[model samples]
Target chain A: MKIALFGNPNTGKSSMFNLLTGLRQQVSNFPGVTIEKRIGTFKIGDQKHQLTDFPGTYSIYPHSLDEEIVSQVVTNPTHEDFPELAIVVVDSSNLERNMLLFTQLYDLKIPLVLVLNMWDIAEKNGIKIDISALEFLFPGTPIITMNARIGLGKERLFAAISTTNKAQELSPFYDGFFPSPIEDKDAQKQEIQDRYEKLRTILPSIQGKKSSVKSTFSRKLDAIIIHRFWGYFIFSAVLLIIFQFIFAFATLPMDWIEHLFITLSAWLSGALPDGVLNNLLTQGILPGIAGVLMFIPQIALLFFFIALLEESGYLSRVVFIMDRLMRPFGLNGKSIVPLMSSVACAIPGIMATRTISDWKERLITIIIAPLMSCSARIPVYTLLIALVIPKTYVFGFISLQGLVLFALYSLGLVAALLLALVLKKFIRSKNNGFLIMEMPEYKKPRWSNIMISITEKIKVFVWDAGKVILAISIILWVLAAYGPSDSMSSKIRAIKETSLYIKSTEPQKETMIASAKLEGSFIGITGKYIEPIISPLGYDWKIGISLISSFAAREVFVGSLSTIHAVHDENERHENLQTHLKEARRSDGTPVYSLATGASLMVFYVFAMQCMATLAVVKKETKSWRWPFIQLVIMGIMAYVGALITYLILT
Target chain B: MIQEIAVVLLLILSLAYLCYRLNRKFFSSGKGCDTCAFSEKGKIEHLN
Candidate 1:
């Protein structure tokens, strides 16, 4: 059986679909998270059913691309995804508003199982629905009340589905609600108003008296949260605390992971036989993986906070407040959701633009989306901040490093808005964008859902980034370990022949040979070739090499550095990448990761479109190489200029 | 000499694997990236 789940936005329709099919399609408190139709399967007894979770829409008439999918599938009998049975999941708490789509679907004469999801929320709000009365009004349709989040009514729902093979023969509610031609706009509007008028009369009888407790509390909270001045202040303060907490809480775990990896590498280096495979294992792969994994604590914490905001319904309020600020930049309040999602990743952030109806606004949002610093840049920022920024406190509590990290994130948002303002001028649109969304009642965060989200995000990060890091590490180790012809060995021999080499201790001699061999190797030659181009940004050839490798993903910059430094100081058992970088010196005896260099690199990462994955998503979303190509060039120039200015100012 | 040959072979295999994955990510599967959140769904429902 092909079952289609449809509902108004945020009615827990996707939640019911997930409960039925046992697939975790990303569900949040807000609407439009499921912007595409998702298909999953569930089996009851010997019969299997394919369930499609269509994007939420208020009516048959569509406003956005997401809503169009619902209209396209539900209205057309010959459509491939049209369903044999439609499950109309409505918010039991808001039946009058929710039943508009249900009645419209009824006028289509399709079989529907009216699923009253969030029944618990309705009951808490003191909404008593006389189920017998509702069933009488919409005779023969199975009305099942379910709390989908907690799986309260699964068996009854299954029983209802089992009995409902087809919609029973019954008179239409409106008797040809679409009597006028489909293209007649005025007729459609009148029909909708007529439907609402009819619903108001019938709903009062079915719905018992409702307590105003929850709504009163919610409205009072919103007054302060979405206030013109207090809202922005509170939002900024919330961000300040989140960044501070990430930096403060994650340091201990990050340090332990770094130490553990360094100890393991040293042990393996001594235990394994001295050979190429041993070098690759201890110096190449282990450190590369370590560099990526050490920042898991921070990444997990970042996702946890985002999940908390989303679950608590505060994210929608943030979007509301940001809408006012975004209007001047040729963006609507809707653009903020994608920009906020970009903090996690730009790919989904760009994909989230489907919810915006205006073409010009959506395009501008897509172009500026990459300017938001994503989680991939977290490791890069953390490393650079730890390298140069002091460990001092600002107000005896705020870590100076944390403040700098927060500033970097803020800088990305500022740059995105500025770019959108510029793009808004060139792009012309006939439609003006507006946001009309429901503010879901704030609820306590679900710990299990937060944990699941954190696990999924971390898995994507480690598994996806680990592959690239390990591969590049191996290739880099090869390039740094050996050189063309007899270049490395000859360089080592030449270094050994120097009087300074003979006069040095054993460790010092090994260090000299290591330096000589690295400079003579393949990666070294390539890095040196590009050194002049990047010199104005206070980067060495080694940093230049990392810059090149990090084009695969922004997070790869850390692994690239670890691999390079691991190869450079093979004889030295450094405690961590930070320690190795700290001790590194230039040929002129100045420190390599100086304040100017570290700040410049962080600025560069903040503006650079380093992730090819992001560019690929842009290409797919925009359906053209032109936009992604333009993004690459514009961001590349911005990164260079930004880095150059930072270097010059700091130096 | 055995270790040297082993290292060379391993490098070749890793490079090949990288190329294969990249091909799958970009050209073959048309999924954005294996790392992408929507990578499991090879294609999003098109607006067109």
Candidate 2:
């Protein structure tokens, strides 16, 4: 039998879903984490069933996009044809808001169940719910109290799900939006008051807490974290820690993944035999795909930290603190969440902008959100950082490489604010709506939710990005390896002959020298064509070609560079791209990667619209080729100017 | 095979574009900023 789970925002509805389905979605005690509808499947009693997990919403009233979906699903008359067995998950600690949805569902006369999730927290806070009283009040529906964090009382929930009626009617949920003044004003008021009084009566019996102390704990947590100055400091420290932790903690797993990918690529190369097909399948495709997947550990870890912050209710405080800071940028405080999310990827970051009610704020947030250095930037940043900053020692214990890495990230944020500020003045918008967010009660985040969230991130990063990257790399290999011209192969033959001649001069390094020279012959030519354009921005032909190819994804540049440099599919052969970068010389023997060039290229990528997928998404989101066109022009100019300045200053 | 795939992709893309154009010409002139908050422009007027 199919079951539908319903709950107010910030409720442990997701935890109950995870319990019932044995899966987790990143759960934050914070409001507004799950923006899109997430669906999963499970089997019960020899029957396969689908579980549709709607975005968390407070009420059935269509206020936000999430609420609209919830209202549509619950009130769909045709849902009667299917098993609309709704298990109303409630935060036992905060039942008043949950009751708003519960009362509406009850009126629909639908078969329902009450799950007092987070009962463990309720007990800790000295708040109690009489489950028996709840059962008596909502006679038809089963009332099951559960601590959704653990498996305690979960079987009861599933059993309740099994016995519930398939199709039950529900009443329309309402917030006290307006009061009727014409129809015997006194009588109408009396009627409304009576209904409220009736609800107020059973509500007290079901919930032991008085209305005076509701959200007191949350209020206390918010007081310190949302302080005008302290809150800002706390948020900065948290962001720094989270970011620094992603690099520090994920290093081991990242190394392991790197090793795994190299091994797999080697095995694939050998398994498929030495041919065009084999080279394409292994060297081109596998390594490119692996390049993306190798970063999955860091990506997952980043999400894990974000998930924890969200679940612990710290995220809302961030939104509250950032509101005043973001206002000057023509964005509201609500835009911070979306902007923060953009650091993960711009796709969800753009989607997260939907939470901002103000159209002006939303548009500005959406436009600048991509400027945040996403996980995609990690590969490029790592490459440049590897290629330029020597890890050995610079000034102090703090790795100079780390400082440069931090600056690159900070540059993305700086660019975002500047773009937002400019657009705030330039783009005429009508929306002036202010942010109104529910600050959820702070608690230790449930581990299951964090696990679920991190897993989903890993799954998507590997499955989605890996596939496309692999395909593009192989295509690039075809283009560079064969080219549309014969000069490519003949040029490589010429290089080979020269390398043999030089064998007597440098016998030990002949093999290495020959391979490097051949790379200059094939992909090098293509890079040279783009070299003139990129030279102004301080990029070499090699960096130019990688940047051009990485339009598909920035991460693929590492694989492209690795392949071009003739790095073997082995860990030992993977030279530090940074030292190689520093030592790299042109045919005329001048240094290839000067400080001016590296800084300029970095600045250019910061503002330039590089991701084709992002462009396609922007086209879809704005529902016009016009917005993307405007975006390309405006942001592209910003990129050019920014790169020009960086090159000038650094030189 | 890559050529075949590319050909099919181009065909499908153009076909979809044609359908989109036809739909826009016939259906409500394609929303014209259904959710836009800009009060200066007419509700039906499209943004460049």
Candidate 3:
């Protein structure tokens, strides 16, 4: 038997689903829509049952895309996922409001098992529920008390499920509440109001409160956290702390990973015989893998804080506070979550726009979301910031490097809002967006959930981004290692015999030879071809190569550069790539990565639509090539203009 | 000479494997967002 799990948002439905399925859940889309369908299986005695967790909705009358999905599947008997049984998860502390949906489902004639979740919270709030009385009021439906967060009331829920019979007709309780085959809009509204009135009359019989007060602590916390004046201040402080934490916590692990990879590369290069296999291991594969792995600490830390903020329910308060502020930019409050999620990665951020009911707001949100500097941009930013920004203390406390990082992030955000304002004028959206979010009560962050989220995000980064980086590295290494047969060998030999090379130290001679060979290689030719186009933005032929290769992924910029520089310097094979970049000089005897060039590169990365993965996701989400193409062109122009301006100003 | 041939063949195989993985990730259907492991399957339909 297939069981459909439905609930209003934030009713512990996900917790119950997690409890039932553990790690056995599979997430897919509903047949033709982007709404996620999560399916899991569990055994009841000798029989296995499938549980489908539908997107949460307030009432069966759909207002949003997610809600429409629930209404469509539940009402259509011919639907592929029509359920044999439905479990309506509800918050016990807020039974009155939650029962509104239950009554609607009851009228729809769907058999349901009421899972009153957060029963512990209800009891602590001095609210008492008469489960048997409530069951009596809605005949044939079973009510199970549950505190899913702590894994309580599972056996009882299962027992209730076992004994419950699937009802094929509407319950007697819904007889007078709904009009049969209601067609008139005005009449439908009257009918809903009448049902609520009836529910209000019956509420006292099934629910009793020792005191009228509930959620005093949440209320007290919200007073300050959501205060108009102090809320922004608190949020700013929170963001500052999070950035500081990311830098402080991730530096050691990043250093260790970098050291480990360098040592491994050095060892492999020495141990293996001089051949393509050895070169592939040390030059092509290891550095690429290291580049992806090195950023895991920062990525993991960012997701860790985000997951904590979300799990603690503070994020919703941020949405609540920022809604009015976002409205003038043509985005609604609901766009905040997706935009924030974009900071971790834009793909998920774009996917998260599903919750917005207004099509125009959601579309604008998707279009501008990539402007938020995602974790993929972190590697590029860190490389440039470390190269150019002085690590001095500001105001005797703030690190200048951190401030530059903060400025880059802020630049992305300010650009996103400003662009949204412009897009708002052009995109013809008639729908007026409104926010109807529930602020979930604050609670201690669930360590298990946090760990799972961090692990999953890190795994995705390594495997998804890792594969592309690895491929690019291998292909690039081959191109950089072998050039046109005659010119490459001749150039190397000529450089080795030069009077300048003969007078230099052993390390300098090795460097000279490696540099000469690279210049004659195929990859070098390609870079030189594109150097004219990128030189205006303060990039040389080598940086040109990285800029082109990294379009596959922004983080790949660091990996590609590391691979190119590593392959060229045998003496500095184990030296840090940053050091090599710092010492590199242009044709005019200035450092390749001077402050002007570094700042220009950072600016370019900030505005560029560089990630093919993001474009692919945008293509899927919008289901058209038109939007992604426009995005690419517009962002490309912005990047060029922005970088050129920065370079000129700094130089 | 045999050892050199063997090493070249290994490099070719590795490159081939990488191409296959890249193709699967980028071109395959029902896998939304190649960058996110937890991304849902199926392309989003245009909102009417």
Candidate 4:
């Protein structure tokens, strides 16, 4: 039997869901992991059920993404999977504000059970809820007072689910959904407001105290974090540390993966018999693909920290602080969360854009979202940082490499805001509301929750993004592996027959040459197709292929380069891929990955909307492919122009 | 098979225990949730 658990923000609806389902829950991306949904399952009396924990919102009258999603789930009849039972959970402590939603759900009159979660919080604050009185107020339903945060008061919830009879049908509160043409919409809204005031008059009779209690610590922290001057300074400093760590500390692990892949590729070439098929699979495919996969550690680690910050109740603070600065750019403080989270990946970040209600602001937020230096850009950035940004120590304290990495991240953020401001000229923003957020009380983060969140993110990354990337990498390898020609085989033979100077120390020179010859022969031709286009962007034919392949994912470029270099049978002797890249030259013997070219590539990846998954999500969230298409064209032009300027200025 | 059955049996046991706890709080109490005094302490500190 299908049952839907729906509720408002801070209503303990999620807490109840956790109690009911326990661990039998999986979060799936609405498309893939990045634009995912949380679905949990539980059974009551041998009747197993699925519960989709939709994003919490205040009303069915939509404002943000969360509200729209819940509104669709509550009102829509055309959806194939409609709920047989709808359980509306509310906060009992503030019945007046809480009743605003309860009345609407009551109007719907589906088989309903009312759960007052955090009932414990209500009683402590000296609030008395007359359960029978509330039941009398809203007829034909079971009312249960429960504390879902702990195990207390949950069984009656399950029983209410299992055994509740159909609720008595209540007449529509409004003649229709708001803004009716027949009557003045404003007057109808006032009438609804008057009814809410009438209910408020009797609420005190059910409560022990005149008012419910709110946490003061959250209020104090919100003040400091959201303070105008101090807030921006703290935000900039925190961002600086995060970028510095990614550049300095993440490099060791990155280098290890690089060496591991190089060794594996060289070993595979040596062991496999010298054949066209072996050459295609081992060197051409494996190394090119490994570059994309190797970034999981850095990207996963970045998300792990973000998840921790969110769980610790600090991410909301960052948004609160940035709201003032970002507001002028057609975004409110709430838009900052999506922009910051987009740094991990754009799907969640774009979905997070639902927090913005104004359509103009929401569109602007979605458009600029891809510009935040997401972790996908890190691979592209890291490669450039290693090549162009010199390894010099600044004041014997900071690494120059780290400084450049930090600058790149800062540039991306600056560019995002600038673009958003430019877009403001075209968009008409309807922002009126002040920043209202439930600053979740600062509790020492539950380790278990952080772990679960990280695990969920990684699972989405590996299973969803991973699957698409892996398949695409193999296809790219094939394209680079075999063209519709026999020139590739002869090229391999020719390279082997000519080169006299051999390194005796490394045992597998012949296999490497044959593999390298195959790569240059077929994929070389393919990469050359777009070489002229990207050549001005400071990339050669090999880079051109990687760049084109990277349209599937930006991280794949690193892998494509890895494959190209490792094909020459070079192994762990080079500390990193940068050494091989440094030695690489053009047809006339000039260095290919010059300082200008490398910088241009980094700028391109920063602004380019490359992830197909992110595009799919934008299409899904915006409810049209129109937005994603516009995002692609606009960002593509910005990236090309930005890269062109950088290359031109330097060269 | 024994291990599988045991795992299933344990899962059932967990559900039954959760049901017992939920039922006691919801059916019998018929009062405010914070009346328990356990979660009330957090609320007291939170108010400050």
Candidate 5:
């Protein structure tokens, strides 16, 4: 059997799916969390069934692309995903609004088992739903009250599912409404009003309430949290504290991990015979993996705070307040969701634009979405900030490095807004976008869910990104290790003829030879080819090489630098990447990572479209090669010009 | 000599794997976002 779960947004529909299917699809305390259909399998008795959790929608009438997906699957019986039965999950505490979706689905004539999820919440709010009365009103429908959060009513749900084997010959809520498709907008509005009127008549008979009133905690908090000025202030303060904690709390673990990798690399280099394999492991693979793993503490910390804000329903308030700011930039409040999601990665963020109804707003959001700094940029940002920015505190407590990290994130946001203004002038749409979203009742953050989300995020970051980093590291190692015979021998001969090389000791000569070999290597030659173009932006050939390689993925920049530096400074085998970069110098003996160069490079990364994954997603979403090509050209120009201006100002 | 040849083979294999992944991520059409790092974690099954 194929069963489909449907409900209004934030109605615990996905929570019920997770309970039954034993899959951890992301269930947050906000709407539009499930932008894609999540499919999983579960067994009932001897029979196994596939269950799909669709994006939440309000009615059979589609408003946005996500809702259109639901309408298409349900209205067309011949569709492959058309379910044998449907589970209409509704919030029992707010039964009136939720029942609109149920009535619409009921008239579709599909077999459904009405699930009043969040039953405990209803009871706690002094509201009681008479199940037998609801059953009598919609005869042959098995009504089950459930608290899906804790699996309180799973057994009854299973029993109800088992009994609903066939569609009942129940009376339609509106007899003649369906046969003639209500094509006119006025007719659709009239039909919806009629349904609500009927629901009002039936609600008194089925619902009973106690003397105690519903809680107003969420309303009380919203007064301050969503206040025009204080809301922005509190949000900024919260972000500042989060960055502070990430740096302060993660330092010990990050240092330990860095130390461990360095010690391991050193031991391996000595323990093994000095050969090609030894060099491959110590110089290539270990450094790359180490560069990625050392930042695990920071990544985990960042996701930890994000999960809390999301699960506690605070993120919805951020979206609510940010809507006012977003409207002037050719975007509406709904654009905030995709923009916020892009902070984790832009691929899903672009996919989330399906929730936006206006074509122009959606297109504008997709174009500017990647400018939001993502987790992939975290390693790049943190590494450069540490290398250039002072670690001294500003207010006697705030770490300067953390403040710079926050500023880089804000820079991305500001750049995104500015570009959206420019794109808005070009793109045109007649329909105005409206954000009709629910303010889900705030609740305590669930620790178990937060831990699971963080673990899964870490796993994805390591495994998916690790594979690419390791592969590129190997190729880079091979390129840096050798060169053409003519080029290599000529460099070696030229270096040996110098008085400095002639007068140097044996160890010094070996170090000099290694440096000469790296400069003449294949990768070096390639980097030098682009050096002139990037030199005005304060980048050397080495930085140019990292810039080229990191196009595979933004995080690969750190790995590339680690591998390249490892090969260049063979004598400093025990030093970590940060120390190696700190001591690097130009041919003029000036510091390679001076403030001007570091700031310029960081600004470049802020504007660059470096992630191939993001490009692929934009291509898939827009269904045109033209948009992605334009995006690439626009961002490339932005990166070069932005970096050049920053270098000039700083120098 | 054997170790050097083995290292060289491994390098070639790595390059081949990268090429294959890049092609599949960009050119191939599929149900999911093929290049997305978070896709494996998200477990999205596009109904289309």
Candidate 6:
């Protein structure tokens, strides 16, 4: 049987769905709308039923696309997801306001079980409910009081569902709820107002008096949280702390992961015989996998903080505050959520753009969303920052490295906004964007919800991003391992016969021959071909190769560099990537990763569209290749120009 | 010699598999990446 769970926003309906379904839930979009449809299954007495959790709405008469979905599905019997039974979840504390939608559903004659969710909060606010009175008023309908956060009232809800009849019979209270269909719009409004008047008259019998003190407290808190001036300050402070915590907490784990991979690589090299298999395992696969795994600590921490903000309801206030600022840039406040989400990763951030109603604004948000430095760029930023920026402190407290990292994040934000301003001028839209978000009341964040979010996000990063990195790494290994058949062998032979090779120690001789062979390899030739294009940015062919390989993922740059350098420099096999990069030099005897080169590379990563996953998601989200292709060209040009300017100024 | 030949064949098979997976992920209309939070149903739903 198909059951539908419907409710007003902030009624704890999703929480109840989570409790009922646990991990059996599947998320998809409703037909013709980007609004998410979450379905789950629960069995009662060996009979399994599908429950569809519809997006929250205020009434059957819809104002927004999200609400239109609910209106269409419930009113249209021919719809595929038309429910046999409807579960109308209501916020118990605000029953008068909540009953607006319930009355409509009741009049529609859909068989329903009323759920008085957040019952504990209602009771604490001094509101009393006469359960038997409610039962008497609405005959044949079961009312289940629940605190969905902790899985309370599950047994009773199940018992009610198991025994309830499936017939669509309206309660006696709703007999005259709908006045006869009116032709005029104003008449329809008058009828709705009359229904509310009748509901008010009936409210006294079933509901006891509630205090206004609790609501007043919420208002007073919002006064400061959503204040024009203090709101921005608090939001900035919260963001600063989140970034600081990520850097502080993730360092130990990141260091451990780095150390573990280095040791494993060394062990594999010692144990395996020298051959193609050994090189693939030790040089190509292990380092690539390690490169992906090393970023998990930071990624997990970022999602943890975001989940906390969302669960606490502060994320909505940020939307409220940012909406005003974003309007002049052609975006509404809803764009803030996706932009903030992009800080963790752009794929989900782009997916989150479904919440935005305007097409032009949403497309613009998707185009500029990736410019926000995601966690994928963290590896590149950390490596480059460590190389160029000294680890000294400013004002006796702030780390210089931390400040530079903050500047990179700020640059992405500023650039996204500026680009949005420019795109606003070109993309025409007649729809005026408005924010209709519900400010969910502040509460202690649920730890279980936070953990689920963190685990899911980290899993997505590792598996999705991991596959791309691994494939690219293997391809890179092949390109670097072999060269033109005879030329590579002859190059190695000639290097060994040189006076320098003959006079050198055993270790130096091996290093020279390895380096000589690499210079003749396929990747080496490809890198050289692109050297002229990248030379203006202070990059050699080696850096050029990394830049090309990293188009699969920005983080892959580090792995490719490590793989390429490890191919030749066996003595530095176990050395950390940072140390190896520091020691890398061009053929002209200049350090390859000088301050100019490091800064240029970091600038390029900040602006470049280097992630295939992000590009794929944009294509999927916009339902066209046009936007993603345009995004590629725009970001690529910006990266090149920015890198050129940075390198020129620094040198 | 046998070991070398086996390793060569294994490498070829691995590369082929990698290429196939890459094409499926980035090019074809399937859920390109399983780990992406966006549902495959959502991506393919609108296309049809």
Instruction: Highest DockQ: give the candidate number.
Output: 5
Q: Could you tell me the lDDT of residue A425 within candidate 6?
A: 88
lDDT tens digits by residue: candidate 1, A1-651: 989899988888778877898876678776667777777788889899988888888888877878888888777889999898989999888888889899888878788899988888888888899999988888878999999988999999999888887867787788666544546778778888988899888888888853224678888999999999999999988988998898889999999999999889888888888898888888888888999999999999999999999889899899788888888877867788788778899877887788888877788888899899999999999999989999999979888898999899999999999998888778877787777677878888889888878888998999988888888888888998888758777888899899999999998888888888898899988988999999999999989999999998998899989998998775657558998899999878899999999999999999999987888777777778898899999999999999999999999
- True lDDT of residue A54, candidate 6: 74
lDDT score for residue A11 of model 6: 74
Per-residue error (Å), model 4, residue A202: 2.6
In model 5, how large is the Cα lDDT of residue A345? 85
Error of 6 at A294 (Å): 1.7
lDDT of 1: 0.85
**lDDT per residue (tens digit) for residues A545-571 in model 2:** 777767665676766665544332222
lDDT of 3 by residue, A101-164 (tens): 8887777777789999988877877788898889778877888999887789999988887887
Which candidate model has the greater DockQ, 1 or 3? 1
By summed lDDT, the worst window of 10 consecutive residues in model 5 chain A runs over A175-184
lDDT of 5 at A285: 88
Q: Quality of candidate 2's docking, in CAPRI categories?
A: incorrect
Q: TM-scores of the models, in the given order?
A: 0.94, 0.79, 0.91, 0.78, 0.96, 0.88
Model 4 chain A lowest lDDT segment of ten? A27-36
Give the winner by DockQ: 3 or 4: 3
DockQ, per model, reads: 0.39, 0.04, 0.27, 0.01, 0.46, 0.27
- Top-TM-score candidate index: 5
Clashing pairs in 1: none
lDDT of 5 by residue, A530-591 (tens): 99999999999989988998998999999999999998766755788899899888979899
Q: What are the per-residue Cα lDDT tens digits for candidate 4 across A170-243?
A: 65544453432223556646755865776678777766666566567766876776678877777776666666
Residue-level lDDT tens digits of model 6 in A262-328 = 8998898889777877787677777777777887898898888878887787776777787776777
Compared with the real two-chain complex, what DockQ does model 2 have? 0.04
> How well does candidate 1 score on lDDT at residue A380?
99
